[model samples]
Target: MSSISIAWIALPFFVGFVIYLLPKLDRYLALSTAFASVAFALWLFVVQSPINLQLIDHFGVTLILDPLAGYFILTNALVTAAVIIYCWHSGRTSFFYAQTIILHGSVNAAFSCSDFVSLYVALEVISIASFLLIAYPRTDRSIWVGLRYLFTSNIAMLFYLVGAVLVYQAHHSFSYVGLRGAPPEAIALIFLGLLVKGGIFVSGLWLPMTHSESEAPVSALLSGFVVKAGVFPLVRFALLLEEIDPIVRIFGVGTALLGVSYAVFEKDTKRLLAYSTVAQLGFIIGAPTVAGFYALTHGLVKAALFLTAGILPSRSFKELREKAIATPVWIALVVASLSISGFPLLAGFGAKVSTLENLMPWQVIPMNVAALGTAITYAKFVFLPRGGEAKVGTGFWAAIALLIGGLFIANIAYPEAYTIANIVKLLLTIALGWIAHLLIFQQAFVKLPRLLEGFEHLIGVMSLTLVVLFWMMMA
Candidate 1:
């Protein structure tokens, strides 16, 4: 691929600034930018890349668009398009569009990075852009949660920067390849930062609230694309550190279970999706190739779920039965929910089956349990409120249609996904999930959708996570 093609990374950034200058044309510009992005990502993926050729190279800075980065860019682009459409349809302004579009560029920048310094700067930009989007509602709660997210993200990135410095001091290079030569403490610190930033395990305690509190389109971007900034690089880094794989899987399994436990009891629909994002990320990180595809599956499906939530008049489980929803919204809700639950013929089934295949036989059982919990958690989506407006916004259908199309991605190539055994397993899981929900999960106890309610607690969790990560690496 030509180096000029790499300018695609900066497209959204420039368009986003133009969006700021021409607030009235935000919708048109943003839509063009989002689609053009998806096209470029696909174009890059289709073309052969020279592995040794840097997409961008300069004084102590470098970037590349290898297959791995291409995959992540595609995932981010697909979701950002959906989110951009949903935001415009939902009547968000140019200012909101500016932050989200800029955030999209930041994500692309992050995934393109080949050096720790570049990655750190990209992530910091991501934090600033996401913080703006998170606080868009300007409510006391939105502001507070946004600040919490910003505070945690900044601290995490700061730690990462220090680790990067140490890596350079020891290895005299900032490239990921140099990680193998760096001090163990440096790598541990970097991993800890990524885990927190990516919303994994104890370090990710801020995720549920931060994601749940943001507006739906904003939440979609956060869940679908932003968190990958932390984990996507880790997948590449694992190639350099063989020991990191087992460590990542242990945390992945824990995150999967713990995240679903919170989701099953969540009172708010948005909060449930937030926890599910955490759970799904936990699910996605188990195997490298599977992680990539599963992350793509999740990016599309979760964005649809959040956008579906946005369209519903109801905000909680109980409200679903009582409220009226547009027919399209109702349909989108079921599809997105079922997709996340790994229903047959959907995106989740293929990626998740691949994940299960790659897991240790013993590990498969808990992930299956996590899958079952996912079905149970999403079953509440079925209440299918009382009424419908035939005239939902064009943007809603446009966005939902695009996402639904993305759902079948690469599933056609997976023959195993269509096997009778998997089909039967899915049916039984959903059936059992319904029974469990009817018998017990009835918001049996209010969870505040609660946990990690304070910023101090967030700091505490980060510190504890850092300590454990350090101890593990040192040992």
Candidate 2:
């Protein structure tokens, strides 16, 4: 990589200095810092090269430049930018902006890392930063949530550490290239570790509590990029384990379906979004078991949508479902809802179609359920009562741009597309989602179905147990 690559490394440092010196310039500081980081990452797309560093003579780390990493970096940059814009007017503490800069920089580092050691260190850096960001406002609920995240995250990292030790003992290297034919036990253990951080079922217990409570911008970053830090690594590990055990495929599907089921009824808008993350991840995690492209699209679109969803004001959720939002927030929520529900011609649709195309019809039950579940949750937003104040801004447009960009990518990759069957299936999903909402979730229903409200989270806990059981059996 050129010197520009270092810009990614330097982002957090630069933001740190600004925060330290001109604390009062908080607004401009966040805007400029977010833009700078995205700009640097965008520049990386043009000046791509491999940057290898000697952490040790025997164990150096390499940063690889490829489409996969670029896609993620780009998504992270766009979402962060949108989030910063969304938060620009919100009365947040300067500390939040400063921490976001730090988190973004660490995420850049993590995405660029090519070795296990670098990846692990980078992951840890983001984890600590994320926990603090959650607790920064220092409310009792936030503090308790952050502590829960801290404890669970440390335990997950410990699992990663143990897995790392075993891998190093067996392969004698921390580089991803070092683990080519490792034992099944090591791969399974490492995945078990990573699943926790990836927000996969079971070990992802802390996600809802913390994610739903954090400040909107922070929540966007956490769901959008932070949690995904574990995904590519999981995909890599899954590839490594393909030969050892095919059953991991089963785990992925089960987890994905379960996540959608619980996400169906999650009450808090942010938490509902958080549960969808698990379901979205579940869809992609099952990708390695089928098609590489499925996983690829899922990661890109999921990250973008998650971040965009988080940046909008809390009113976006409540007003849409409980009462009409201000015109601007309502429009933004509409776009977000469409993007997440995978509406025909949207980014989510492409990801869902691609993943489903990679699976058998019988295997698509969960995929259908997940799509329906997501659609239903978002539809609830559509029902928000008549009116509120309106103010649309750059953040809202940024989300629309991302949704369009994702659609463009999908179209380019799969032209002469949109099978009639696919169209019918999508329409059916939307109809079912709407009908389900009317029957069970409508305000007139006088009571929200707790099962639908908390479905994704319930599935998350269940998936976690299933993973542990699978691990035990394999062990």
Candidate 3:
């Protein structure tokens, strides 16, 4: 396909058009659109199409169908596709389908964009769509969350615009290629600006509330893909500039560990999962500074885990917790928990090892401790006993299938050749993590705090403050 021929690849455009034509078809809209979007995005990744261009002058509109963008798009589309299936079954209203499609397309555009202006437009579209999605059900809490998201995101956009202006002033063009000669302070500000979209652990107060309270599938897409939109730009910025300031390390790791710390006290299943997203993103952001390959691994597994969490908890969410105390659901939960904790060879472990291996030993220590903490917090999910079994729902089975497929795909899709050693290590990690959970943490699991009862806004406030302080200092 010619690169420009990708007008059809603008999956969201088609979705938006469909929504306008059939506004009442909310039920099937998200599912059907998601399927179409995923198929197109897959083609975008595989085909040798040139960079998709919409407009060009001194400042052009272009999409780089490169491996980097392909990686993010594939995961983003996969998550949306999985969550759309779950939503179809869960009976969520289709009124938000347009917003979901818009969000998906905007985020996908953000990933593939090759210039600052294009990337900004993509992020802005996603931000507006997310605000709508957050406020879709329009509860008082949803309204509040939506307002917070809208305000915080717009401010971030302003900062990004300022940085864009600075880059344009200095380089005479607004392109990723133009950022190379940009000064350190401008680069740092741009990075911080993008961090808002990424939902860095420190400044991401809007995530848990908006996502956890939104409809489940909305929560899934937001958690699984939208937050990741920020990371792509951050990575691009880091690559463009040569500066290796220590603040990047501090901000990234602090964000990851802080979120994980929040997860330790979080009781709400969805909220806890949201905090985990921050923690996982922390690793991805920090890893690239030290090693290159880890982000790829983390992106795949974390996206899968987020999608799985979003899919689970259809009705008896409350009862599901109670039943989990002594059922087979515990098995599924443990596998996911261990996978996220980097127990050894599971998806998380592969990401962690690949990420931290290249860092200095001392720098590696904090990450290791964070991984251990991740283990402890996730261990709380293992309330179901080893021997008990319960009936599985279609959603439950779907969640299981998604998780396995995610890992399998991650293992295969990685550019590096997979070795038996890696596979063996992953299996070993799963075994040990499970054994350790059963032997040492089983009692603690029973005693863990309830998800909703332990909620606090303190951590969110503190993290936001630190992020601001770091940005100011870097500026």
Candidate 4:
């Protein structure tokens, strides 16, 4: 079983290299490999129990296939498969396909790895591949965005490495399970580093620019899948350090509010979605199982929204209203919007309800506020007037169909999320959001201050956050 798990990690890189050499078959090969990867992950979920594999004795290189890890693996695989199909349909280059496959492999490895060493290696793999993919289009804006992402990622990983070293020195092992009683300093450093990856408010200031500037499909992948790599580990740490749960929850609430506040005022479609990703992640970090479900729904719906943005003639809400979009494209956008807004019977509603069920009464109010804010932000899309006729291809429709199907499947699978009270809450939230949009956003021209727009400013903020966290942990 361990060998099989290792093979799953290796399969994409091996297949990618081969496909890169055979450029003529790149599209077919990439798609086939993606589907096969998803199939293998699902099979493992059904047949396998939790297992830890010690690949190296002295180095403590280990892999874990627990139920929690399995859920992430499956989600990553599904999103990767959809993105590959989008890449093929959009006529991306062979290099793009190769990088995508490599990213898929790295993400799966990150989710399954049992030790800090293996996880760190996987993180590096993902970072390098993502940088290349974000810069793949070679536009001036994209290259600059990619570089910003690379620098921030390297700095965060350095923090993680230092924390991992501290843990190894204290415990003589780098395995997550072995670091049970590690010092607060070590845990704080590790948490701060992962927070940068998770797209949390202060540390993840690099997210909006990077996600909004990348190519549409790449934006989808970054927002929907890549950001979660940082988040999953953070959730694990929170579970391990129960003493820190209160602080994590406070950060989560603040992050959620900050994300939605910025998203509401942002006019750029992709940037709005990017901020929403940050906000949803903030909510998810408070509860792991609910986070898993939320991640799945968010990945699918967010990808679909990004892909839909790509096909639109213009990204400006006012311009989009003036131009005609394809019927299928409009339909896709509507489904994605409702899902993100937590409309009853949709994926977002189910996940939000499940998450709220696990929270304290006060925590529930903020989450509900965030959900309402999300709906209000998305209302612009719903009311945008449609004008010029555009034709969408089979690939676009296929991606949309797959995402919507996933949403329905999520709702069906999580029936516990559909109680009468939750259903009423969902309706009220949407109603409030709609009213807010009309009474506030539509009636006034508003713009929030872009305080974190500069990279240097973001670095300062991240530094300040680390200092504060350290002080808290020490005190």
Candidate 5:
């Protein structure tokens, strides 16, 4: 079982290196490897047990196979496989495939690793691979975006390393289980660092620029899977740092409101989705189990949406409406948009309901408001005019089918989320969102200050966030 778990982490890197050596077979190799990884992860779900392995003196690596990790790994692998299928004919180079596989392996390692050191290593690997992937196309914009990502990521990782050193000093171990009763300062630093990567507001100010500027498939992977690398650790922090729930809740609410507010005003389609990603993280930071569910639903649907956006020929909402006339693609877009908006009977609805089920009454209102904002944001995409046409292919349809199917399966699998009261809440949120959209978002002049769009401003905001987080932890 332990070896199998390790295999899950190792397989992708191995296959990726091999594909690099044989560029002609890159597509076939990547597809087969991705499918095999998904199958193996599923098998691990059945046979794997939580196990801790000692890699060296006073240092050990742990593989946790609990439902949370299992669910994340399974969903991540599935999305990766789907993306590989979509990219098979996209004329990507061998280096792209190699980086994609490395990204997958790094993320898998992060999800399964139980020690802070291992998680940090996994995060570093993911950061490097993501930087390369973002810059893979070698466009001037992509290179700049990737550089911003790299700079912010390095700062985050530095904080993570500092926190890890503090943890080791305090507890003599870097393991999650060993960190009990450790200093709050150390934990705060670590959490704040992870928040940078987690796509929370302030620290995650780099997200929209990077996500919006990257190539379509890279954007899909970034929004869908890579951001969750930071999020998974945050979920663990929420569970482990029980005393800090209030702080987490406060930050979560702030981030949710801030992200949705920006998203509501944004006109670029992918940028809007990127801001929505920030808002959605707010829902997850305060609730652990719900975090997993929300991440799964969001990752799958977001990937499909980005891919669908790629098939269509527009970056602005108005242009997308005027240009996207393919029926099958439009249907896929609707499903993805509705799912993100928490429409009843969809995966997003289940995740949203379940997340709300865990929130406090005060927290509930902000969450609901965020949900409504999400609806308002997506309303642009769903209710827009449709007239232009683009060629749809097998990859697009196959990827869309898998993602939408996952939503239905999630709804069925989590029956508790399907209650009448939750359904009513979802309806109210959607209705309010649509009305708000008409009143506010539909106005031509509504726009946010473009200050947050600048890389230097974002760095300042991230610094301020760290100071604030530290003060909050001390208080």
Candidate 6:
């Protein structure tokens, strides 16, 4: 690895600080940062290796640009570019661009780190930047949700830190190899922390409110990249620790079902998409090998969906039905939503089929069920009218066009998805889901339990989940 590769992490941080000093240059700097990231992601694809990043004179950790991390960084780069491009044409402030660029840099850092201590540092940076990005709108609600995100995320990291301490005491290293001889309690704690951060099942109960209340572009970042921070590493570590794989997939299945159920019943447009983010996290988590590909496609589709939401007149379904949307935005929404729902001949179908083909037979059926639920969830928005011109700028279309293009580009992994058998199955899934949507959409909204709704409740759930993870690990 070139020592110059350190520039990958350092350059973004430097640009972010520069953005703070020269706020007037924020948009150009942010776009430049995105373009640079795209260039580096391309480089990592061609040449993969581990770089030892020395922070202090005597201290350093390894950061690898393995294919897994490369895939995620590429996805992160493209979505971040799309978002910055979208904001470039908007009336947004320099502060938003600066923070977003910082957030984008932090995620790239997190994706590249190979050791627990460095990963934790990167994750905390991501959390802080994410908190700032989501709350930038400064509404009372946005502020409240942002603080809630900070508090919960900090607690989760505390578990991760403690677990790292336990592992280091036993093995005296921060590398993933250090976890090789660590106790189950230690592993469980780390798993619990990552589970919450990864947006799995009860642990990720914070997702909907955080994503929905944020501005559209912010929501895109949250769903498309933020939650994947924990998931990418978790999947990597799971591949190392065989005992953790089934456990992660178990929770992954639960997350998919729980998220899609909420999405199917959701009335708010952004919130529904937020729920869909949670569901796709499940998909990515449930299949470790295909996760990079699945996450890439979903990330691209989600950016398109959330950005499309931003161009809309209202978030409420009733209001959206009454309003006429622009042709470009509407087409973007349909294509993105269908791709997300695993429609045949789309990026999502390929990813989904890859996931199913890789899963244990017993696990396949429930994942298919979740896939069906996904179709039903997106059905609510697929036919929204494409009549009015929304006065959006070319940058907006440019961003969406880039993401939609990436969707097809991502299909290189699963050409077998076009097989007649898989196509028929996916078609049937969508047809049934659409029928179910027709039946269910007319009913009043279903309310979920309030007992597990907030930060305090989530803390309790995390404890319970930790206990469960311990039992699973020890068994």
Which ranges of candidate 5 are over 4 A from the true structure? 44-54, 321-324
**What's the residue-level lDDT of 407 in candidate 1?**
86
Query: Where's the lowest-lDDT run of ten residues in candidate 3?
Result: 446-455
Candidate 1: C-alpha lDDT: 0.81
- Model 1: per-residue Cα lDDT over 266-320, one tens digit each: 8788988988988988887766656777888889888888888876776877776
The RMSD of every model to the true structure, in order and in angstroms, is 2.3, 4.7, 4.8, 1.7, 1.8, 2.0
lDDT, candidate 5, 283-338, per-residue tens: 87756756778888988988888888776677877676556467667778888888
lDDT of 3 by residue, 1-475 (tens): 5444355457576776688678777546656666665566566567745455546676777656655566667667666666655555555455566777778888878887878888888888888888888887779888877777777777777777877888888888887777677765566567766776787855665676667777656676777778878877776655555454344556578877877777755656777777777777777767555322344445444544554554444322344555433244555566667666655445555666666554445557777656665765676665533454444457645645664566655644443324567556445544554565557644343333334322244234434554565465455
* Global lDDT of each candidate: 0.81, 0.64, 0.64, 0.80, 0.80, 0.84
Deviation from native of the Cα of residue 127 in model 3, angstroms:
1.4
Give the winner by TM-score: 1 or 4: 4
Q: What lDDT tens digits, residue by residue, belong to model 2 across residues 128-160?
A: 888888887889978877776776667667766
Over the stretch 409-444, how does candidate 4's per-residue lDDT look in tens digits?
777868887778888888888888888998888655
Q: Tell me the spans in candidate 3 whose CA falls farther than 4 Å from its real position.
A: 1-5, 24-29, 40-54, 244-247, 289-328, 343-346, 358-362, 385-396, 414-475
* Backbone clash count for every predicted candidate, in the order shown: 1, 15, 5, 4, 0, 0
**Model 6: colliding residue pairs:** none
Superposed on all Cα atoms, model 2 deviates from the true structure by an RMSD in Å of 4.7
In candidate 6, stretches whose alpha carbon ends up further than 4 angstroms from where it belongs are: 48-59, 442-444
Question: Candidate 4: deviation at residue 449, Å?
Answer: 2.3
